[model samples]
Target: MDLDAFVSAHYGEWEHLRALSSRRTLSGAGADELLDLYQRAATHLSLLRSAAPDPAVLQYLSTVLAKARTASLRRRTLSWSRVADFVVRDLPAVLYRTRWWWIGTALVNVVVAVLLGTWVARNPSVQTSFISPAAAQQLVNHDFSNYYSQYGGADFATHVWTNNVWVAALCIAFGVLGFPIAYVLWNNVVNVGVQGGIMVAYGHGSEFFGLILPHGILELTAVFVAAGSGLRLFWSWVEPGARTRADAMAHEGRSMVVVVLGLIGVLLVSGAIEAFVTPSGLPTFARVGIGVLAELAFLAYVFVLGRRAVREGFTGDVVAEDRSATRPTAA
Candidate 1:
C-alpha cells in the first residue's frame, strides 16, 4: 500500500500512455505501444484499487485508459443512407399506419366546410353576420382574385409556405393536448366555409373555386394530416393499447415529427401551385386538374409506398440505435 513508491515506478508508463492518447495519429509502433501501456495501466488501476489507492494516480489512469479504449475502437462514419432509409421506409410506413386517422379528419372537415358554406351562401342574415354588405361586395368584386396576384409569385409562395408550415408545426407541437387540435381544425373549417359561402352568395363562387381549389386541395390535406397526427398522439397517451403510455407517446410523437418534416415539402408544392399556377392564365379546368393530380400523387405515395413500408416493419421512429434505452413498464 505504498502509494508514492507505486506512482514512482509507473509514472513513466502512465506518461507514455497519456502522450499516445493525445496524439492524433499513431504509427504501428506507437499503436502497439499504446495497447501495451493501456493494458498495464488497467492492471495498475486494479492494483491501486486493491493495494495502494492514490486518488490522483487512479483518476489519471482511468482517464488515459478510457481515452485509449475509445481510440482503439473504430468509429462509424456518417452517410446519406439513414436519410434515404427514412424517406423510403419510415416516413411512408408511419403515414400508412395512420392513414385512417387523417383521412377521416379530411372528410369531416371538408363536409363541414361545404355545409357551412352552403348555409351561409343561402342565408342573407348569416352572410351579414360576419361581413357587411358593402365589404362583402368589395371582396367579391375585387379582393378575392386580387389577393393571389398582389404579390410576385415567388414572394407569395414563400409567404404562403411559411404560414402553412407554421400552422402544421403548431398542430404537431400542441397535439399532445387533444382539444387544441380540434380547435385548429374547427377554425380552419369555419374560415373556409365562411369564405366559400360569402363568395358563392355574391355570385363569385366559380372564381373562388378556381382560385382556391388549385392549392387548397393539397394544402388542406396537409393540414388534416397534421391535425390527425396530433389527435392520435393525444389518444396514444390516453389509450396506449398494448404498450406503456410512455412507449406509445414516444413512438407516435417521433412518427408525427417526421410527418411534420414531410409536410413541409407537401405544403411547399401547394404554395407553389397557389402562387404561380392559381394566379396564372391557365384555364380553370387545367388549374384544378393539376391540383387534383398532385393530391392523387400524394395519396398514392401514402397508400402504395407507405403500405409497402408498413408491411416491411418500418414505423417512422428513430433508428433503433438512436432511441433512448428505457426501463420496461407494464401497460
Candidate 2:
C-alpha cells in the first residue's frame, strides 16, 4: 500500500468525521453520516496499520475514532425528557399494575402480625419463652425507643435506607423462586409479632405502636410491594395465561424492575421518617401524622400517575422497540 496515496484518499473523510463529532447537535441524517464515516475511518486505520504502519497517521486516526465514540455515546445517553417520562409514566404504571399483589401481601402480613401479637401479648408463658421478663422490660422501657435514636439523624437515615433497600431488593430478586418471598415476609411477621407481644406484655403496647406506625406504614408497604412483584413474577411462569411462559415472564420481569426503582424512593421517605421524625422530640400525633401524609403521597402518586399511564396503553414494560422479540410459538 502506498501510504501517502492512501492518506490523501481518506484525509477529507477524516476531517469530515472530526467536524461531525465536534458538532453541538446532530440530526438523524447527520448521525447516520457520522457513523458511516467513522466505520470507513476505522477500516482506513486497519489498512494503514497492516500495510504502512505509519505512527503519526495511526495516532491521528485513533484520536478521531475516540472523538466519534464519545459523540455516539453522548447521543445515546439519557436526557432529562427521557428521565421525566420514566418518572411520570413508567414507574407509576408498573406500580399500579402490581398494586393488587402487594396490597394482598400487605393485608396477609398485617393479619398474621396482629393475631400473633395478640397471642403473644396475652400469654405470659409465650412472652417469657421469647425473651426473659427482665429483657422484655428493658426493650419495652428503653431499647425499642433507643434503637431509633442511637445514631444522629443523617447517619440513622442512611443506615435505615440501605437496610430497607436490601430487604426490598431481596423480595424482588427472589420473586421467581416464590419460597424466599414467603420466608422473608414470615420472618418479618414473626419479628413484629414478637416485639409487639413483648411490649404489650410489659404494659407498653402504646409505645410500640406509636414508635412503629410512623415509619412502618410506608416501610412495610414498600416491602409488600416487593413481595407482590416477586409473586407476580412467579405466577407469570406458573399460569402464563394467554401468553407463552417465556414471554409472560419476560414482560412481568421488566415491570418488576420499574417497581424496584420506584420502591427505592418510597423506602427513602420511610427511612427518613424512621430516622428523624419517629425519634425526634415531636409529639406522637405529629410524628404519626407525618408518616400518614408520606404514605398518602405514595399511594396517590402510584394510583394517579400509574393508573393514567396504564390507561394510555402503557403496561410498564419497555417501549415496543426495546422489547425482546416473541417467537412464533407465542400464544
- Best lDDT goes to which candidate? 2
* Root-mean-square deviation per candidate: 7.6, 3.2
Candidate 1 backbone collisions, by pair? none
Q: Candidates' lDDT values, in order?
A: 0.89, 0.91
Q: What tens-digit string does per-residue lDDT give for candidate 1 at 55-95?
A: 88778889988888877763444569977877788778888
Model 2 CA lDDT for position 247: 92
Runs with alpha carbons beyond 4 Å of true place in candidate 1: 1-78, 327-331
Q: Return the TM-score for each candidate structure.
A: 0.79, 0.88
> Over all chains combined, what TM-score does candidate 1 have?
0.79
Q: Residues 201-287, candidate 2, lDDT per residue (tens digit)?
A: 778888888899999999999999999999999999999888898999999999888888888888999999999899888998999
